[model samples]
Target: MLVFLNQRLVVFSTPKCGSTALEQALAPMSDIVLQGDPRIKHCTFHRYKWRLEKFLQIFDDTPMATTALIRHPQDWLGSWYRYRHGSWLDGTPQSTKGLSFDQFVEAYLAEEQPAFAAVGSQARFLTHPKTGETVDFLYRYDAFDEFEGFLEARLERQFDLDRVNTSTEMRLSLSAHLAQRLETCCEGDYALYDSAHAPRPKSRMRAFMQALAS
Candidate 1:
């Protein structure tokens, strides 16, 4: 993620997204600085809250903006699981320790239930702590090409995606039951992605005709 801090362009990095590439792009520039996400603290009550407010203070409201790249939930979950467990889609243990994908998915899906909902609920750049207003201009992890253009236009500089570790391969390739469970569990993320990548009118009409022919 990238943002303008006190008239100097800065990068606010998230864990996965293409922060590595963005960090590389801004390296040569003296004005642009890179800052990692401050929400990684276990103490959300005090340390996290203080860090967030301090981050917000860096922007004095003079045309300040922040950019974040979000990946598909399934892919994100898969990567997180693999990083923790060091295992593939199968149950074979690749790592010394970590929860299985099934276990993570089950707990993630159950987050919608009463007690679990607030457990995983954490704030990001888009979220406002005091006003509860979510900032806009969020980009998709799937559409890196378009996002690159957005960065160039916004920052007035070209950005290269070469240094990033982005892979097109789907990780989990969920089975029927797992897919259904995911769809039900991650409904909100799915809807957001749908709205972001909604088909054009022409494409929609073409798909409609194709469906009719079938």
Candidate 2:
């Protein structure tokens, strides 16, 4: 995660959502960069707001905004499957070595997921625990250019992001049953992604006041 104190912006890192590229590109400009552990570095919005932010009370009065990127649930799982299946993880318990994508997804949807299919949900990462509110800005992985443009304008700097931590390319296909199970189990992720692309609502009271004055 990268925090810009002057800008009052916090970029929450969502796993397998191009976070490495973002971190590499923005770390140099950030005031506080979390890099000690994967868990701390990729701290979720809920954790940051409830725990980390409170702990860092120096910035309590700062008007902060949060941002995150999310990918399609199936594609997110596919990335995890390919990454764990790589040669580097061949002998590890987390290795997806002998498993097909369908099998991996089945494990993912199981009540108790196998080590290889235990990646956490993106929707949960960006949401508030009690209120169910998401980040101030949520970007889709496929629409990164839009996110990049917004960041550039907000930070007053241009970014030339390099691709990092990319998994090997492979064609992934899910069985109908596995796909259905994934959709049912990860419905929140799909809903969050859809919400990210939706248009923001106008303030009805402001519009009403303006119309009355006119």
Candidate 3:
């Protein structure tokens, strides 16, 4: 997470959402940068509210507004699968070597996922612990240009994104049955992603809907 105290802004590091590159680009301007460990780096909505928010209150007059990004649920899962398949994890139980992407996804949909496919739910990350509160600003992960514009306007500074933490690319197809199961299991993530596109221009929103349908 990157917190700009004077600006009352916090750019939350959503997993697999180019947050590493964002932090690298913006860290110099932030008052606090929590990263390195995954837990610290990906400070979720609940963790921030229950722990960090109170600590930050000592230094601020008002609560900081959070900004984050979301992606299609399948895309998010694919990223995790590819990331775990990286050679760096070859010896670790987290490695996805030898597993098909469909199999990895199957593991994820299990009642209890193993380490390799235990990528947590995105909905749980963004929603409030009890109240289901969402971030003040949520953007589609692909909509970096608009997200950057919002940040630039608030911070009054220009910025750019660099590709970072990207994983290997491969075409993997899922069975229709498993795809249906995934739809049911990750419904919350789908809903949250859909919400991010609201209030978009008619042309853009229509195009987005078409893309989703396709």
Candidate 4:
């Protein structure tokens, strides 16, 4: 599960998965940008029109690490729902408006677009490119402490726990209805999630997810 990411990292951020916080954390380390396509907020492809490896190599040449924060599909779906429909009920600014989670998922299923697609998926980005080699490390946001520990040890630096734990709230609670709906709307992703064996609920995964979300 640990593959050395050619020394440079590219975090393939899925929307509303705490990618912003991670970008901020690593931002201080280098001048590189963590976004895939600025014009397309959620697009996986870049303006350069390169495949995975070519895009990856562009960053591999830099002194930066290409990394992104990913979250549990169930949790991420909720977050995406909130962000798209309105801001956090806690008073954060809303980013997008129009469409309920159900509606959006329906659109995604029907249109097969980026925002609607890739739910419950990690394999495409988490796996290797050439030899199908994955990254040196696939840090699970759910395993925050361990992941931070791994980073601290690797970089020989201490990270701020208070800052790291910012905005740690489950946007939506797990519900049977939501799960069933998600399974129906995102069948491919649901299956892929099972195949990937994404981390289950636990304090470790919770902490990691919090770090990435903030």
The candidate that achieves the highest TM-score relative to the unseen native structure: 3
Order of models, best lDDT first = 3, 2, 1, 4
lDDT of 4 by residue, 94-176 (tens): 33245455554554445455543334344444444344444444555566666567666655666564333134343445446
lDDT tens digits, residue span 121-186, model 2: 998888887999888988888878788887898899998988999998999999888788888878
| TM-score to true structure, per model | 0.60, 0.89, 0.90, 0.53
What CA root-mean-square deviation does each model show from the true structure?
Answer: 7.5, 8.9, 4.4, 7.8
Global lDDT scores for all candidate models: 0.52, 0.87, 0.89, 0.48
Ten consecutive residues with minimal summed lDDT in candidate 3? 197-206
Per-prediction count of colliding residue pairs? 0, 0, 0, 19
lDDT of 1 by residue, 1-214 (tens): 3434543343445455666677677656535343544344122323323454366566563434544556666766665555544334245433314445565666556735322111242233334556544334556667766767776776677756675555333345555687688877666656555544322235778889989999
**Residue 170 local lDDT, model 1:** 38
Of models 1 and 4, which has the larger lDDT?
1
Kindly report which residue pairs in candidate 1 clash with one another. Answer: none
Ranking by TM-score: 3, 2, 1, 4
Model 4, TM vs. native: 0.53
